[model samples]
Target: MSDIIRRDPRAEWIARNRLHPLHAAMQPVQHSWMGPNGVIRKNVHGVGFIGPNGIKRIDRSGAQQGGAAKRTAAVEVQLPLHQVAAPAFYINVVPDMVGGRLSSHDRDLLGLARQLAGSDGAVLAVVFGEHKENAFATAGVDRLLVLDGHEFDGYSPEQRVQGLRAVDNQFNPRHWLLPDSRSGGGELGRRFAASLKERPATRVWQIKGDECIGRAGAGQEDLARPLPRLILAAVECADPVSETRHEVLPLELSTALARSLPRIEDLGAVAVDPAAIPMAEAEFIFSGGNGVKDWALFHQTAASLGATEGASRVAVDDGFMARDRQVGASGTWVTARVYVAVGISGAIQHLQGIGACDKVVAINLDPGCDMIKRADLSVIGESAAILQALIVAVEAYRNGAKRDAA
Candidate 1:
């Protein structure tokens, strides 16, 4: 054997091609090993063994891979803690928290509140009722206040205003920030402002120094005015807090809330069909494309997931779905919180349609598909199998939730 090193270009090419039959064999066996810091590292994919039929079988735990140092059991990220022992002032934020989780709009509002809070001031998030959110610290909330009561549940804006009033009397926040959207925030902010007899800056997109900029008169003009005590901020007002984590100290109102006589009667939620919800307004959209072989299964999956049905241009052109269900640059532009693409190749137009979506999930057999590139989560598998698994998972989740509630 010569001491000189010789590189094989063909072997290198084969190793680079993950889809190639000889790709895994040509690659170096890197399973698990201890890092420089003595932390165990594992290659999760390297743990799988060849089955009797030559099919690769992956162990969900990846214990075998842990021995190869390919995957870390848990990647713990420790962000700098922003502590406010005593606050000079307070910037109160009311998040929509749709689906019991922090929406992008809510995070943006909190970001704006953090800007106002500064170093001395603290960002206090006021959540109504019970929420499933557990990331208040990461969302830039220095304090967390939950107003949970049967009286404050449902469509009791008046009671909510009273609660806010009690909060106002206790903390007297320097500024109040709320999301200026249709999902309960805009209405609540306006009502709260009325109760306080203070004019709120509505539709605010930018806030600087002593000036706030917002949209006015059907969004045809820019309205710049002096910063008010209450602000109803629009989406993307500021980038969400990503650098540091806050203390998220729990706080309670020292004073009792004054119960208001309800002029509005409490009416329970009305059931509506997911299909009736427009793609633009739908929070979750399940979209299919030309690669979808079982259209019936696609529809069933969407129905099971409780997501609005949408289709790529190819699927629409093929007459597998309604023209109104098409989602692309040519169709309706969606702003869904979660957009699931099934068997979609991700055309430029299709990608453009879902550009405003917060999270994109791609399900396709082809690992190199364009949709996979744009997706936040990608599962390379048969669409049918994935959809079926999703259905089963959703059912299990619902059952578990019911059991917990019971």
Candidate 2:
């Protein structure tokens, strides 16, 4: 009887444990377009199978649509602990065009949100507007909560605050972020924080876990340690203040404070490293703006003075120069020793970025332009003519200095 038909438990287990492959043998593939032979070519897009017989033709109806890469799974990223539980951030949507499309601050805010939202943590963005879509919808946000209300379209700060508050209540987001600008944003943030008693970090460059870090600090040394989440409603600075008022301080005032107060170790506020702040040690700066009609002459003047060229957002947006070199709400903040504003209108957005300069010279034909009021020295003349003349004067001054040294 075949050795009494002894059964091996191990062999039985192996046969029982054999796994059926958990996937379809032949996934549907599709045709795709490829560029070849200097022309778009159509070809089979993915891998498939031939029958076991290897000769019989079958229907190609199983192929899925939309090229070759079949959608298999949802994409997701694990965020830090605080980000997971922290209140989602609501980016109060700014208009794409303001002041007749002359202002680019809205676009700048959108860009800043894209940069800040993901860098610090996985904070979701809640966009509010008539369109009510993420200005950064392309950033692969997990969830975009669009709150569309007519009040937002009307530009009512109170309405905006109320709408935002309602959304916040529903979501119970723990943190709020906004840009530092004169466009009622500061007031809105302040009011919202007051109403909800939740922490608001305005003009926030970076958000760390649940803690928001900034240059703004309460003056008391001990108070500086805990670092309260407050409105950084102005550009960032690393200086001590005689008085810490929540009110926004002009860039010049903050710089003066820095000079007056001695730097203390572990002051809590992020200090402005001179190296990081542009043009802080510059002897001369040639600034240009939309008023400077001739790009070639602007370049020539900068070259003549051996000065770095600065352009306002107007010039940059109009395709006259790159954004990095642009000076305005969306551009680099600077504290140059000497600043020359050529044809710039000195809008509040522009002023916020360069108000720390020691000396400002304005060159423009429009005496009424706001830049004239802000400049320590105002020259009322055409930019081209004034720039050409100034370039010669600077060159002569340099040559005279060399001769005197000799």
**Best candidate (score: TM-score):** 1
Q: Compared with the true structure, what per-residue lDDT tens digits does model 2 show for residues 1-406? A: 4668788775555444313121122222223322211122222122343321243333233324432123224233232221223424533333222222212233334433333444333333344553422223332232344445444453555565565666555544433444455545566667667786866555443334454444344421211222233333333211111111111111111111111221222323353432233453343567788788888988888777667677888888899977667775567656565688999977657776665555689998876556775688999988888878877898899999999999
lDDT per residue as tens, model 1, 1-406:
8899999999999877756655545544545543222234333334464422255545554444433233245455476799999999999999988877898789879888988888899999999999988889888999999998888778888988888889988998899999999889999999999988999999998888999999888877889999999999988787577667899999998877767679998779887899999888899999999778988888888888889999999999999999999998789888798999998987767776776677899998887656886799999988888888988999999999999999
Off by over 4 Å in 1: 1-77, 322-324, 328-331, 347-352, 367-380, 388-406
Cα miss at 111, model 2 (Å)? 35
Q: How do all models score by TM-score?
A: 0.75, 0.34
User: Stretches of candidate 2 above 4 Å error?
Assistant: 1-284
For residue 94, give model 2's deviation from the true position in Å: 44
Q: Which ten residues in a row have the lowest lDDT in candidate 2?
A: 248-257
Deviation from native of the Cα of residue 206 in model 1, angstroms? 0.7
By summed lDDT, the worst window of 10 consecutive residues in model 1 runs over: 35-44
**Residue 77 in candidate 1 has what lDDT?**
47
